[model samples]
Target chain A: MTGDTELRDRQAMMKAALQAYVDRANAGDADGLVALFAPDAVIEDPIGSPLKTGADIPAWFADTVAFGTRITPVAPLRGSHANEALLVFDVEFTPPGGEPMRIRSADACTFNDAGLITRLRAFWGPGDIEPA
Target chain B: MTGDTELRDRQAMMKAALQAYVDRANAGDADGLVALFAPDAVIEDPIGSPLKTGADIPAWFADTVAFGTRITPVAPLRGSHANEALLVFDVEFTPPGGEPMRIRSADACTFNDAGLITRLRAFWGPGDIEPA
Candidate 1:
């Protein structure tokens, strides 16, 4: 295949991988969610310590789920190169007997040659739920 | 010009623009430094308020010079598109009769269609200089 074709294929795979993570997370499938990352993937969430490996991802996910946070990953902003992409969107969830909170975040994802996510850096603001 | 030639020209222009900023800052030429940005440009420094418009940039530059800060913009990490670039470098300076401080920062710059810088977002760690 040509270089352009290869790049296109890699981009498609990356998009699928990112969507799968969001799907499994929202579905509360911890194992499936963690399986999307590489063995030594790094995830830096906005409000938590960075997770450096696959082993640590499960605990992080568990904590997020425990917090009653649900993430709905939106469409990503494609970079010029297919190896990198940026996803910006909002998340909504409710705490125990409390009103729903909405958070907007931007995640920059870099994919390895194997099409697995190597780095996922998330950026968000810390604030309480504002009335809509 | 062809697409590749156009991209190359833009990249060279951007490199020159960034280097000019560093040179002028190091030489304390505040006027020349601010001339690089567009009239309505926006600059978000690391430890200060954002400066909007060309008029606000001089005060910001003057304050930085007064703080004994010297910025040396190193090479940029080029994005896929020539219009966007990421610059990661370190700055070193000493306060009045105090030890020198070195700070590492990353700036993402976006250029307008005319190739003038429209947005400059800076990121850095707040700390003292460590031993080399």
Candidate 2:
């Protein structure tokens, strides 16, 4: 394929992979979310938060996405030249007996050829949270 | 449709829109690139550069993507929750009778519901350029 076509195709694949990630998270399927990663994947959901890899990733998802947390894309998606991408969205976390808190943030991710995410670095902080 | 499917669909559309943008730029299709933006889209390429809007956007594309400049994504694309996203990539500019320079940068963009970009803020500086 031509260079443009190849690049466009890669972007599409990357987009699909990212969407699948959100899909899994939105479904509250912690296992599904973990399946999107490579065996050696690294995850830093909040940049400075504890780094997670391999078997440690699922727990992160379970802890984060549990209790009916939902994430929705608030803006358009942009692709970089490599298979790495940054995603910004609103994450709504509702504790069982607490109010919902909305946090706006983004994550940078890298994917392997198999389309599994190999690294994810989330960028956000308490300041990004929407006021109640 | 379920929320997951709807979200996936939106993500797909966003990816296609972003891909069209890079394709237009790589082909030196200045008009095509401009057409990707909404009528009143805002463009702040490099963030520090003069902001471009309305009729001024075409000139920005001409000046920036002109010559034999090529952009390649070094990372995957991430979509925000608001139809906005950030793209990180390397831009290679070969000035006529000048050496080629590769600069790494990222652009944060917002799109209208129609899939046309409404705002674009590029994040980069001279420091992001790679040494030959």
Candidate 3:
């Protein structure tokens, strides 16, 4: 097969996986969210924070869901290459005691050959979110 | 041309433009940065802030450079589609009365058929930057 065709196939698979991820998050299913990543995937919810890997990723997702966080894509999900993608979206959250908030952010993700996310780097900060 | 080939060519052009933007910014040439934008382009340096258009874009670029800001790409620049790309980089700032700092952020830029930026949306927040 041609390289372009292969890349196209990979893009399709990743897009499907991302859609499923959004579905799970919106459903508040932490376990479903965790199932999307490879067992050893590393995730940095905010690019500057400490990395979460292995089982910690699930815990982090659980914490996010527990905080009433919901993610919705704000733009078309974009593929950077065959195994990498860009997800630009809005994240809504209601903190424990703070006002509800909405943030516009993007995440750059790298996937493994098996279509599992190997790394997820979220690009957002406190200033990115506004009171909703 | 095939869709894939056309996309690849457009991607190349956009990448070159982005590189030039970073180079001009690092050199403190705000005019050069403005040259990259369409005459009536709109730019939102941070997703939630006011939009900068036409002559305002140059003013914004001037203000940023006047603050001793320098940009350097920290990751491989990614193309989202034929005319849109993602630039993840760091912006260094030294304020008039503040210490030097560094910000990690991303910009989603849309290009016109003529290869100029028609809209540039920067994804960053007050929290994305850190003390250098």
Best by TM-score: 3
TM-score of chain B of 2: 0.86
Which segments of candidate 3 are over 4 A away from where they belong?
Answer: A1-31, A34-132
Q: Which stretches of candidate 1 lie over 4 Å from their true place?
A: A1-132, B47-54, B73-79, B95-99, B127-132
Q: lDDT by residue for model 3 over A6-93, one digit each (tens)? A: 7667767777788888888889999998988999899876654678887788788888788888888865565533366667778898
lDDT digits (tens) for residues B6-89 of candidate 2:
545555566677788778879988889888889988887655457788778887778667656687875556554335555556
Q: What is the lDDT of residue A32 in candidate 2?
A: 85
Candidate 3 residue pairs in backbone clash: none
Which candidate do you rate higher for DockQ, 1 or 3? 3
Chain B alone, TM-score of each model? 0.77, 0.86, 0.92
Model number with the top DockQ: 2
Q: Estimate each model's TM-score.
A: 0.46, 0.51, 0.53
lDDT of each: 0.60, 0.69, 0.75
| Model 1 lDDT tens row, B59-101 | 8777667766677544333332336544545677766656877
Model 3 interface Cα RMSD in Å: 16.7
Colliding pairs, model 1:
none
Question: Which TM-score does chain B of candidate 3 obtain?
Answer: 0.92
- lDDT value, residue A39 of candidate 2: 94
User: DockQ values for all predictions?
Assistant: 0.03, 0.05, 0.03
